[model samples]
Target: MALSPCGNQSAVPTTFLLLGLPGLWETRLGLCALFLLLYLLTLVSNLLLLAVVWVDTHLHVPMYLLLCALATSETCLSLAVVPQMLVALASLHGTAILSYQGCKAQMLLSGGWACTNCFLLAAMGYDRAVAVSDPLRYTTRMGHHVCICLVVGCWLGGFIVAGGMCGAIFWMSYCPGQNPLNHFFCDIPPLLAAAQGVTAPSEAAVLLLSLLVLGGSVVAIVASYGSILVAVLKVHGGRSWHRAFATCGAHLTVVVLHFGCASFIYLRPKDRYTLERDCLLSITYAVVTPFLNPLVYSLRNREVHTALHKLLVQRRVEG
Candidate 1:
């Protein structure tokens, strides 16, 4: 409710201090530079993916629409976390400060966008399954209206879940004296670690809600891929087999990296959470994974490569 600097007074701290990777304090500036570079590249690549999808009418399909949404989520998630993280890394004390409201905003956006990506990935997996299993009806089943509804549902569901998570976490009394977050961002674990009056029911509620989002999405992805694998095996052509593997390979790679990093961070017991190790591992999901999505899809998806080439050639002719 009130703000005080770290050493300003012996009053309740209404602000949070983000302790950036303390183990690498001496190299904070270097880390900051590296993160900044990654953020820019992530933005450019994701934006290019969105633009390519938008301009290439040939890609105006359910799958590419889901990808466009994923790119958007990745961009927003990076924006929510990376800029403030850069500030923390560049701070003289290797820390950054955030007001209570600022911290909640960060938590909501980061959580919402991350959740959106998970759902979107599941939706994409289902799209691919339908494509492989029932190509003739793929267009009918995944029509434009259906895809739009799915995208809207994913965004709405993501923020709604995030809102509930944030509300539950922030409802408790924060430990005023223990206002320093061990991680660079106002993540759920760090915030819970610093909060007082955390009851078993409240913690269980939060954990259950998280598991519902993640666990449900994982089940959907597995089911979709299982169907895909069955259909691919039923087919008798190398071309079909090659297409299925290439497409699923890219999506599976991303799914593994994204879900693996998230599971490592959120699904573990509280006692196993070493702040230092967790903070280091969070960079993979928070930064590296977003940066890798465009690359993985571009390298693995032949249609994307052809679209990019066509766009480049069109630009050359126009220029």
Candidate 2:
């Protein structure tokens, strides 16, 4: 906690102002409405996927179990950021102020849950590879216990990573007058950008740590998919190829969207930041990505679709 200059009291760096969507004044309301719709869609779709997976015995396999865990993470991620963003967007000047506790909480949720989603994607990719490459050994290799361990590891690892990064950010002293963060929620770059002074090293460390986590997951996903590709090509069966594509395509789409949107390609020096573009990227990743995740999973998965259809049909029959 840093001391506020106004009074020599133990003042935490509370009340951060988020600049939700700067320079988009004209379209802010429309964007807000659009994101509100997308937010709701993400919630409903992921929750439905979870519920479907939970009750349906057929979706009890490792792949579907991983997917269910993913949906759960996505639901948590969206809830952590979207509602607060909506509130921020409705505010005057597109600035939403958050307490230190709230800011740190959002960072933990978004950061940890995003890490969970990334690792889950990698895990899902690995699970698919095992299925495609060694169908016979898939069940034996990826037993229920192994699957549980993988999911738990992802969730736990994400929290540890996020806790380290957020703790680093929150401990720094935020200078007055640098209150407006370019993104909708409290994130690493923005928080460091607004810190008092001499934070480059800390910021670099956080970025490096984040890259390490993401990079490791990416390596795993690429390796899994690469092996999957080789195995699918070696097998001259069209059905095998189709199955491989169906399993990997959705996961790949999600990977591309999530990483592409969240990547720091446009991240220049702090003074050179283009806030509107940054906010747009944040919004796309935070809002649109979650909405797309379950859509891709559900449409590509026949078993899940079948389960969902049966559930609806049974409800209608009972009615």
Candidate 3:
């Protein structure tokens, strides 16, 4: 059979190499175990947090609703990349080869969930602003329909944006000799670097589009939080202001970690593609953020804590 150049018969490499953290030979086992533990915590904690939000009547508020969405997105985002990474690390495969389709799918899901999270966090900031600025109209303004719309918008926007970026990335020909990805999964930057010769134009376009999406999202988030800070300051009572700050502080911390790491990775110029820095930042968002989200939100939220206690008691009685 004569194989077409554009088809799968283009002699596509079945496996790709993954070059993990630069110099961790001494701590390889320790690092893998730590990441494994973190992944377990991320999965269990996020699922529990989501269940609590769903079942607890006291948590039927805008803040908790947004938290649930955030948790869900984080779960998806982490699942898209982390488990595969763990497997690769466990096997100690110098080069991990993923099928072409699998690589594309992983990239799609990761980018989609990450982008959706960006918008969802912004929506959360907006929700906080309304809750603080118009305490009287908070319920009416952030009603069921409005919340659904915002959540839907975030997801839909993320899907479209990520799809576009991934399409731009994969719409190019590939020759031989470039199969190893520096990172675990098929991230945009690493993939682009791999396709250096045959798809230079497409790679450049993908990089630009990613920058625009990430840069614009960061600007929106900053603006939303700027307004939120202003609104927080105008409250009358010291106690009320302090409570508001406390409520939003955890969210602010997560937002900073997410955007700060992502910006350092994506928004920087192509000339600054340091493998060490890239790996570190990727771990921050892909690993650390997922584990932190549940801890920060669930532990700090009195309602979640109370509901969990009740559920535990109920389980004990049933047992």
* Location of the lowest summed lDDT over 10 successive residues in candidate 3: 1-10
* Model 2 residue 36 CA deviation in Å: 1.2
Model 1 TM-score, 2 decimals: 0.93
Best by lDDT: 1
- The CA lDDT at 214 in model 3 is 73
Q: Which scores higher on TM-score, 1 or 3?
A: 1
| Top-down TM-score ranking | 1, 2, 3
| Model 3 RMSD vs true structure | 3.9
Q: RMSD per prediction, one decimal?
A: 3.3, 3.0, 3.9
Residues 2-62, model 2: lDDT tens digits: 4444333335454788876567777778878998999999999988998898878888989
Q: Give the runs in model 2 whose Cα sits over 4 Å from its true position.
A: 1-14, 176-178, 265-272
lDDT, candidate 3, 30-101, per-residue tens: 777888899899999998888877778888888888888889999999899887777667665433567777
Which pairs in model 3 have colliding backbones?
A: 15-97, 16-97, 17-95
Candidates 1 and 2: which is better by TM-score? 1
